[model samples]
Target: MVPIPLASEPLRIGLLGCGQIAQAHAAALRFLADDGVARVSAVADPDPEGIRRVAGIVGDLERSYSDGRELIDDPTVDAVAVVAPTRFHRDLIAAVASAGKPLFTEKPLAPDFSTVCEIADTVRAAGIPAQVGFQSRFHPIVRQLQDWVVEGELGAPMAYTIRDDQFWPTGAVVPGHSSWRAERSQAGGGALLEHSIHSCDIACWLFGPVARVFASTRHVFGFDVEDVAAITIEHHSGVVGNLVTVFNGVRDREERRIEVFFERAAVEATTDFIIGAPEDSLLLKQDGAPAERFDVDALRRATFAADGFDPNREVFVYQYFGYAAFASALRRGLDPVPGIADAVRAHEVVEAAYQSARTKGAANVADLRSR
Candidate 1:
């Protein structure tokens, strides 16, 4: 593996893809650059236009390559971020791991569970620090919900309901950048994998590992992949929840809401996945007490402070926080949270849900993991 970078040295990050998501990482890296945490030193993408777009955001990159492998092999790149398509993740991850560079990859590690396992094994064998993009985990309201669950501040957890709806990527929402998301071979699955995989991860993070799942799906957009999926999950902790994910025709609107019910309390949170959370984003009620509202900005500042970051200097977007955390972990020579192992666990639940949909019965998550 590459020598662990000291905390004082800024990590030189090489980005493997310069698509839409890559732009977000570039912007985040730009923010981190001011703090001497990291900088976008190199970028690779087949599209010259994409490369140009990201270079504009990061400003003065050391190098840009048309081939991702060249960027991976570049001596000056201290780490690599894989923002490629889901179908390309396996090979890119293997290349980055083999290069002995730390990796930060976007979510749903791969389209299939077995390939996700293969990627995890490759990263483990290489002894590289790796993190997957489950960015919502970095949101302060979500962190507060986790604390409430873990500290038993809300008695025993009972159930949860999470609904995530977005305008279909292949539709007018994202334009030219999102066509691959509609293809089954490229995206692996439909709404379940490309989108709600975050919901699966969040469900497991908030409650515990999923025990079993029963699911049903629909092809509202008539793509080869299902655009709508409804899943019922039973957590190992005895918490049960229903998740509904849809890729619809809603223009300029992306909605996400998470409501968890406890034995004595209830918690609800709402936010735009593209933008950040709105004011009064969190609501809590315990027993006979009135519901309490929380300012999401204040909660976010407190969360950043607890993590030893200056809230005023940090970007408020949830995606930026994940990249920041990854950069911090790289500086400290430590593995980041929501790592590949965590991705595998979340994928296991998703794969089980798919299996249940196929067989029209509950599928055991442990059974999928055993193989």
Candidate 2:
């Protein structure tokens, strides 16, 4: 088995956006920098305030620009992070590809299917390392669940269910809310793309490539896009799954969970990358036994037992592993986990879901596989 690569020397990371997600990425980079992982060399955002805000957190930014093109073109930058809004992802990705820099982009690849494929094609042709911000995949619980399932501890693959019902960002207030995410032309879709895309990617990662997608979405909150969606999927591994993403729920709590049922056993995981959540547990159950629960703390202890585990470690430390993983992949000249191909495939699934919502029928994932 190949060992996971670890970053060495200096990795100068260039951030392409300073929006909300950029703040999180910058925070992660700060943690990674302590371990000699990477440093934020420069940043770019259209808004002057965006750059100022992120610079406040990242600190020591060598250069700042309002246009992402100028940042990508800078010779001092080693890698790029496309944390801009989805609408700008395609062009930024193309620019980074043209510059031959490894990239890490926030999810949904783009606002539409064709552009997502186009960006992925460009990145693939560039032959540079890339990773997407499917941060949940880096969660230790998720990794353990996937490993156990693949090792047959979950028995033969049967079926799975994914749900990401969040409260905020319902888009009921459109122009009053985060405008880019509320508009169909800007966001592509609502709940499915924004909230459940993570679960969608996880489903395919744990199961197999998606074969077909059937979905129905509604503008429950009168947003320019759908606020609620129910998507059914068929996997090429002969497994079937359903994904439910309802962003308009009138509730105070957020729920993100996925359950995979196998022939003789089952595993269920909840929430996401953010560490130290109350419900962030992974449970497993066999045919006639009781369910076993696993959480971030337990996983951390077990993983570092030989290294003298420290239970009081900062939760943000675990979060930085994803950034380190991306740097390591680039350093080792390996394909990053949840890379461009994965993003493109997940984007295709979401696109097919939109098509299914329109035709009221199952749509083949292959239909949008190219453009």
Candidate 3:
């Protein structure tokens, strides 16, 4: 019998973005710095000034680069975090794969399926660990819901409903803010690429692979791409899921919930709660009312127990766990959850959704896989 190896070495991390999401990643990396588990040894971004500013916030990054290739080629950097922009993911991931270093990257992997598939193949051939930054999956409720789905708690999910609605602030300087997003060459799609990826991937993680899809989307806000979209997905396990994404700036965000309807009953878990059900539907609820809420404190305790984290520890929240978990997986030579192939699948779905909307017909994800 072979003894299980423990992850004991500290990881040397290189960060490659200086944007808003990069700040979140840096916040997570900073927590690891405080814990002595890992450190951001180097940084890089197209904007030298932006790299310097982020380095200042992260406390003395050893090297900075205007081009990410330099940082990837740096001998001392053990792993890389590619957060530059959606368009840059494929190139950065390729560089990291060629260098044979582990990677932690932001979502959707790349803007095109062909490029995404190529990157996935390269990472697998290099045999280096690669983790995608779908950090929201670490949310306690989501974790529990996935657990329940796998454990047959919901008796095999029959349907999944996703509502993703939020008003992206106009003041923030996002890529294509003025024109980039509207251009097809820059942003793959509008809301589906920029925002729908989160909900779509979460759906894949919680339910299963989306086998086929039908969707409708349009440029409601005068953007070149759709600002709102509706999609229907058929999961491999024969489950059906419906997703609605919009930027209507509704008075409240109702689109943040993922509700799974099952044979036994239903499970509704939002970021705010681990469970929601009809009061009369289960033993966990109150009277015969149709709605009940799960407690946040209890969910935190559950997460701490499973992850070996301090229940009372105050840190960078979910992002820190994502970084730490990916680092640990890399050290063990295991591909971290949501790697390059998953990104390719995500992009396929995004493209399928866009095409279905335009053609008014169901789109097969496999058909887009060739592109």
Candidate 4:
């Protein structure tokens, strides 16, 4: 398909929720609007106060709806930005697919692997571009790393290591607030599904598909679900990907980072920077030497955060580039970096990871394929 020119008129967008992540989506839409390419046409939420808050962000001229279905059915809206809870993802995707509009749903696509397949099949059959909100792929360093790998810069990675550590402060989750994140029925798994989805997708993108998975989950922090997890995966290329997901505040680690070891040389790329090659000591290092280093700004020619690596730990709170990329793809026929199919695959990985953790054995990826 020939690539269409960027839309001359602003693409009309609507939000399905007004939660914390939804604020980031709205900010991204505002950024697009500043460029004269997209606008937030409407917002929908059951809470009138929440609806007003989101609507106020895009201006009062935008439409507001008490029910998301009504907003989804609105004829004026061209695309939908779904930042609702994980539980609502399947229903919202199905609803919007039936409505015949492009969609961008936040990650973990649904509560489980089975529901994710239903959403994926629905979007696929409808022939519409439905994007999963895996924003880290849009990070400049990540994109460059993927490009380098695909271009054979690293000479085919033999293994991948991903580490993500976050501290979900106790009081951050308001009590009696009825948050979907705290409920297993809504979030599926805790940190594994909620936070690990990003790392899982990155693993899949770096290495083709998952072959097998062995994982473990423990509620070390006493949350409703597991707060710490260790997952080991075998990719189709026989490459191994080891992932460590932690929600502890004790360890001092980067918020997100991936280290890829290839046949030619090893490359370590983080959300803020990338380093490799003999020039910077990336490959020629005998012991503890700095390699070639590429900072965030040096990558995409656009800087999302001012302070570089330590910009903001709350990644989802300010994910504009990704949402803009998704909006552009849906409006102009470009491919979103991590679309709904990727989400389905990520869900499959998470499900397998949890199963492996429970059974204390390896889980075949093929066995987890939804019916």
Best candidate per TM-score, number? Answer: 1
lDDT of 1 at 99: 88
TM-score of each candidate structure, all chains considered together: 0.95, 0.91, 0.87, 0.85
- lDDT for model 2: 0.78
| Model 2 residue 35 CA deviation in Å | 1.1
Highest lDDT among the candidates is held by which one?
1
- The collision pairs in model 1 are none
TM-score of 1: 0.95
- Tens-place lDDT per residue, model 2, 205-324, is 888889998999988777787778998899898999888888754555676788888888787878644666666778888889998776567785564343233445564534366677
Model 3: per-residue lDDT, tens digit, 159-240? 9788776664233323333345555565667777777787788888877788899998877667666778899999888989
What TM-score number comes out for model 3? 0.87
lDDT of 4 at 100: 77
lDDT at position 189, candidate 3 = 73
- Give the clashing residue pairs of candidate 2, or none: none
The digit string of per-residue lDDT tens for model 1 on 105-169 reads 99879888889889999999999999898987877777888899899977988999999988888
Per-residue accuracy of model 4 over 1-371 as CA lDDT, tens digit each: 23433323687877998876676677667766766667788899888877766666666436888899999998888888888878887888889988877787888888877787877888889877777788767665666667777888457678878877766523435443345565677678887898878888888887888989999888876677778899999988888988998877563333776777877767775552122211111122112445665544333433444323333322332356666666567665776757877877777789889889989999988988633
What does the lDDT come to for candidate 3?
Answer: 0.72
Q: Using lDDT as the measure, name the better of candidate 1 and candidate 4.
A: 1
Q: Which structure is stronger by lDDT: 2 or 3? A: 2
Colliding residue pairs in candidate 3: 163-255, 176-180, 176-181
